[model samples]
Target: MARIDTNVKSIRYPVPCDEKLTLLARKLKRTKRQLFIEMVDYFYRSKKDPADMNDEMLKSDLSRIGNRLVGFFRTQESELLVPIHGMAQELVGNTETVKDELKSIHEKQGDAEKLLRENTKHASEQIRLLTSIFDGLAKMEEMRAGFRRIMEGYIAEREALGWSTSSGKKDELVRRFRLKVDRL
Candidate 1:
């Protein structure tokens, strides 16, 4: 085995450690004296030389550190209401614009479905009319699927933040939103 060098002499403590220190020493698998020596050495070494640190490097380090900290916090078992609140704040701000666009989509979907139904019922004798009706139906289905996707995304985001739709209020809101979209 290689020999380790010790430049400093060990000092003895006259009294026993307090409960916290004793527990810490046991947890760390080291005597209190050894821990103290290591800490003293670390402090002396840190004070001996100052590393060349710059703002850009410090910022990059902080960004990485912040990312790790956020990731760890996100893994913890906790209520997501706070995070959902932030998301709701963001989405709520854009609600008016989204609602306007949804209204236009709803109107277009309604028109397509109505045209398909009318053409299918009254123009069966014309092949071109039949084809157009089928095409309109397909388009309406696509639009409905798109609307469903949008709702799914909203619900998924909310769920990820720990919001459940089991409540009567949330269920009613979901039903109303879907009804409004389907009415188009």
Candidate 2:
């Protein structure tokens, strides 16, 4: 069996006997045990050798880390943020130009549609006029045919009655009718 010291029986360690550790605990207004625990925890968490660290060395190391962080942030701003900001501005400009062109195209399309409607209306009117003109010509041709049929009937009756087909009075009357028809 192993023999354990009286102090080590409960805490598993002997109390420190350093004069500086005692003075530092007094100055820091903490118990010697608390100070020792805090020092051990700090060295363990920081992964730094307590024998190699002092106030000046810690400050220099912190300053170097701060400078490296600042330099990294600056590089990121130049490489990524600057180009992204420029692309955003260019996208805004291009969008405005495209919107203006689309608006112009829409206006031109509206004007073309209006012109097409007007042309269609005009064509319809012309078709109506042409239809009326053709109807008038057909009615005139019918009247001319009826007048010829009546004249032929009259000539046939006179010929069957053994009357002369041409006479001076008839020729004068025909000449007067031709003049009236020409005037009409």
lDDT against true structure, model 1: 0.75
lDDT of 1 by residue, 1-184 (tens): 9888865675555454456667888899999777777867975765533244544655777899999998878765245767778888989879978999999999999999999999886776587778989999999998889788768866775575466545776666667667757766
Candidate 2 residue lDDT tens string, 14-100: 445567777899999999788988998997887776666565667889999999999999999999999999999999999999999
Clashing residue pairs, candidate 1?
110-184
Error of 2 at 129 (Å): 0.6
Q: What is the TM-score of each candidate against the true structure?
A: 0.24, 0.55
In candidate 2, how many Å is residue 49 off?
A: 7.5
Report the number of the highest-TM-score candidate. Answer: 2
lDDT of 1 at 54: 49
RMSD of 2: 9.0
Model 2 residue 120 CA deviation in Å: 1.1
Q: Model 2 has how many clashing residue pairs?
A: 0
